[model samples]
Target: MPSDKFDVLVIGAGLAGLRCARVLAAAGRDVQVWEAADEVGGRIRTRAIDGFLCDRGFQVLNPAYPELKRAIDISDLRLQPFGAGVAVRRQSGSAVWVHPLREPARVPSMLAHGGVRPAGVLALLRWSLPALRPRALKSSQRQDRSLREGLDRQGVRGELRRVIDQFLAGVVLDDTGATSNAFALLLARVFLLGVPALPSDGMRSLPRQLAAPLGDRIVLQRSALHVESDADGWQVHSPDGVVHATHVVVATDPAAAAALTDVATPPAHGVVTDWWATDQMPPGPAMLWIDSRTDKPGPVINTAVISAAAPTYAPRGHHLIAATALLAPTATPPPEDATRQHAADILGADGRSWTLLTRDVIPEALPAQLPPLRVRQSVRLAAGLWCCGDHRDTASIQGALVSGRRTGEAILRSPARI
Candidate 1:
């Protein structure tokens, strides 16, 4: 069979692949993206189930991400912002803490919860404020430590520490608090500056928006099996046929990239998210509910009334609630019964009547964002081979886009292009 050819070929159609293709194509480089999935948006996909929009997993879009702003029209997404507060479930009940800057009127209500200590507040500020300035977070100036150690060193203990740890465990999918302190602080900076929101349709709209400009340059269901260096540049072997390209970008997930190239396998963090629909109007603002009990009640790290944040997610008269539990890559997903019970306990609601919409078991939800943070890993694999993805960056939508943009810039500057 004849081989198809292009100036550049990008594997995987996730955020990274799409962004890289955009940059290269914009530069007048003949580019084509081969995505393995039937549709685009790898992990950032959504499905309509019984009139409910269920994402591959629970995810939110932050408008503050620079790459996000550059990649799509935020206004077109019709963003639905979450309340800048969280409800912490305790032994007694729940306590809500809203950022005073965003919700000053809620200060009295927050103080009513009674866990905010002056010392903890000051320590938290001391630990996190520096992240606002990129120069302050230079890894060389300070040794990167685990979040637990950083919080302890900064004297962020007791209830404040518990709330932060539990809430972030859901965000990073690591309950051990072993995530890099620098990386965590950067994430905090992002939240501090902007509220996370969902698109009117769902998170899938993001990749779809990014892919719009590329037109038919993207060929779905074309999974690249083996990529080998050839005289012209590289040959990507797919079940359909062989495609030759002057440059190849392995923008797949960490595991797939490792399988296809010489890149080392990085540690992975997994998550199990269960979506349940209920006739009960979930009481409370559009905020995340975190289990902060000293003697934890369930496996769920966090629970939220997603419909409260994105009303379009559920059909009229029904609310959509999501509970997420951190699972090891090899561990069995928690049973639906346990997940439902844990969500109930955290939200202090009766979920007995709620219907389980979907349970997503993602063994590779994210590449572990460990300590000694290297924000920009090398994308070039060899003379003409390259790689880019969340695994190559900070393990977020922002990181993925940034890595892809960087890869495109690097390729444009390379002298090896055919």
Candidate 2:
């Protein structure tokens, strides 16, 4: 082994890239990271404009991800907790209501809400009880029922169906019809037991924390053009210079990884988020608000007054509402006027006081997670070459970090990385 060669060269400064580098570095391996973007955190980026910290998209971390303890500490994130259960806006009543799983005392009130039928309550309970059990994991993956289909089969109708679809769309960034049944079980589990949270500073703080230890080992604005191997080992070509490494980790997006590794590129889902600032915060426990109507302008998937979740996200006396919707491939986002007007009505906030701050349209917000949701994805792509990312693993932060760690572990054991 040449002293000048890097033990591992990680491409992409996203969550997976940083995590892979950190693990390799900890094992006394000489590692370097390359990123095409000027800044780190990839899609987890946060921007500060006029004293407001706007996340690239709406994201939340659930406590169920055990990987959090492995990569970073919760205190560094200063997590802001979002209350359990969603606030449903009954399409029939033109009013907002709650399921009260958190407030069990309100169960009777929820039952008598006139819109919620008795059969709906039974169906919801039948689905929820299994999520708490271990069997839900297998059942969800094996069954062909998506969240919407499961609800319908259980005899859930009218307002309950609307409420369920509206809320689930926020998590999956798509309608119930498009979501897989495997995810439905996971959704039930999260709804029942998970505690949703966010970093007080911004979501990007997470990737920053992971990369902080590497210091100068990471190079920015240099994308991984191509990776090849010779008798001398691996050569990772970049715009500025080439990195000579014993092993190479391709931690880029789906399409890039597919191009680099000759692996199939899966379809990606697009999510467009528009932010608005207002003096009055929508009253609640940071619950998600969904649009039950498709005819509504922008056809918003979900809206949340994020300032309620993280106060540092906004300036004094102001709140931020993020109106989100699924975008078609290459389609433009709806105008700000329509998004704001629709959001104001959904959250019951005054439209006059709302001000548009910024709109971030992420073409690849998440990988399309359909049927056969595996608990883990393989990280090794070829001999001495590895790949890891949300596309190669789960579509959430947990999947990205976990896959990166898995790649690091495999690299550590390989004699090639020595």
Candidate 3:
């Protein structure tokens, strides 16, 4: 309710914004967060419907996410790992099974089943070599090649390219030609380091946990209109009112950030729709399914049934499956019936007995540009203005947290704060 007197004001209550507020508030700064949605957790959202816990998409946190380990109490949540293994069903009616690379014996079986192609295995080896580890870069010289270009340079071929492309589509929700190689490699490193796990409850709980300590410091259902700076400090204008603070952090998706400040460019992509089902599907390990040969230009990268790995997601004897597709710039949300049919067809669940439980189309969810590890400008663009988001670093939950923390640290180090 105050007009202009807080230490910091953060926009967008997504993981990035919440994390920023948490760190600043914990440090004894007067911090406040404004979320356009009635609730926190931006893209990381979950809903409970008809005895099923459904998420906006199939999202999981890698055990190796440094920001998660450092910023939140992982022990407080129930974590479920990927099922025994992952399987990829080809259009030719054959299936490929993929297991964690740590299990050498399983690797043979995976290769034999065509789970991974020979070229993919070789490319993985080449890319995974210690000598190829990512290095720090100056903002001006950071590489911006697409994932496709990176794979091609690594000599990925034939069946292996199809499999790898599909998997990347499912994970990144963008065509390889559109995704940044640097970002893809960063994600690969995270996956290679540990198993991916989901919270037993849902992904939204992660943000809720981060917002717990901030308590009443967070403001929900408030849309930030603009942010401006004067000689004294920064002002954040929201639909409810205006808040002037010593520092302002635009912790939103790239487009939203550009709208609020004078940023020259923002990531381009937007909106993602996901559908969830309960009960009636066959039993199997959770897998990321990439339909490479689909009639569509890009593959339909969706998580097949994951309830097996985390039964707590649904009631006993019920399974939870989710499929997500990115919306094109000119596209609108598909009709409910059409989306349902599309889910069944893509998931290969024609005769299965599953019931459609929840479907959500998040308009303007993810930014378009494949996120760049380093932004052209430092976190502090102005004396009292900062920016942070997945578009600045990695695109996963980990990136948001790390960016937020870095922004907080930058604010603390600034002479303006002192």
Candidate 4:
């Protein structure tokens, strides 16, 4: 027996769940969202302490996110674009500015020096060409190959692989060898289209805004323990009570989604850590720095300065530095002191100079860095059940939003539901 019923029941009040609820609610559907946590936003999290606004992980809003623009009011959030370009610092103690494509005339001359290499210039040309720019392909087709394979086939190597791999790791939070080349290229295309921005307040505001209009319709601290479907419709069991609805959406991470229903396969979970300081550090464009010289087991990618992305993130004169390392399921959490020491070593700072503000280890920060959509299925075994997450597309914020929107639209159009 169900405690309550609605036209649509959504699980996981993150960006995807909230977006689906917002769209269905607007269409006059009786919708309700269940969230395991006390608040919404899922991975897009923010925290304030001692006058510092720190995010769980370093996040940037892509100006070209199609569903984000349509689903949320970006103007209300007042996003601030990055200053100009990203400064890539190499292991050999050399650095270069990768200027945004919008200002091609400003390509830094220093990039042509022996220490600096132009790897993606040719691929950029191909993607920019009128004929090669537009092509239609299914996400599944794009996921059948790894990034390394695709790059080798396309003759992208040496210095180009370094640059692309660094950028891909930063965006997807995984190594290029572990990710899909087509998906990485699609991300690069997004940057070429427009600059990445951050909200005036913080990234968390995006999901909060999406969940706002739903009001009391959203249930918090209620994790959906299980979901079972039959001929009639779907039944979702939460800590609170069971809810019967015409359709069920599991928008949580792959692990949680798998636990709720037997239909989803659990994807790999990665870890990300953020450290905040209230003292001014280096001044430069927001960039991803990879220290190839480090002796760490896995590739350690760090972002030196993000204050430029959103100045309000830190106090007037402070800096926000973030570093992420993908961890295996059997790996143990690195000691806080070790993490701080690693940060200091990478940034060339004395470990004691910076105070650790906030640290979060989202064990499932990202799905396994596989080729795109290889493990994702549009339709699950359950008749009226659907799953949505970054794993379903390109492993990105945009992918999550787009997948959520498409799933919701698909459910609404299903004749079986009518």
**Top candidate when judged by TM-score against the true structure:** 1
Model 3, span 154-241: residue lDDT tens: 8877666776676666567665467766766766677777777778888877999999888888888888787788656976776767
Taking the tens digit of each residue's C-alpha lDDT, what string does model 4 give over 1-418?
2337766788888877887788788877777888888899988888887767777776778877666778888888888787455554455554555554565565657556523445556654543332233233234454347766766665665654566666667677666376755556666667767677778778888988989899998989888877887556887777677778778888887778778776556466567675757475754445555554434423356555567567787778777776666555777767667666665565555657667788777767776656553424573445678777776654778878877787778777765452
The ten-residue window of minimal lDDT in model 4 covers: 128-137
lDDT of 4 at 346: 57
**On residues 302-340, what C-alpha lDDT tens digit does candidate 2 reach at each position?**
788888877888998988888887777788877777777
What local lDDT does model 4 show for residue 391?
65
Q: Decide which is better by lDDT, 1 or 3.
A: 1
Each candidate's number of clashing pairs is: 0, 0, 5, 1
- What is candidate 1's CA lDDT for residue 19? 94
TM-score of each: 0.97, 0.91, 0.87, 0.87
Best candidate, lDDT: 1
Off by over 4 Å in 3: 1-4, 92-96, 115-120, 130-132, 136-144, 270-272, 292-299, 332-348, 351-353, 369-377, 416-418
Ordered from best to worst lDDT, the candidate numbers read: 1, 2, 3, 4
Candidate 2 contains a number of clashing pairs equal to 0
Query: What order do candidates take by TM-score, descending?
Result: 1, 2, 3, 4
Q: How many clashes in candidate 1?
A: 0
Per-model C-alpha RMSD: 1.7, 2.5, 3.2, 3.4
lDDT of each: 0.87, 0.77, 0.69, 0.68
In candidate 4 the C-alpha lDDT for residue 377 amounts to: 51
Question: In model 2, which runs have C-alpha deviations exceeding 4 angstroms?
Answer: 1-4, 92-101, 133-145, 282-285, 293-298
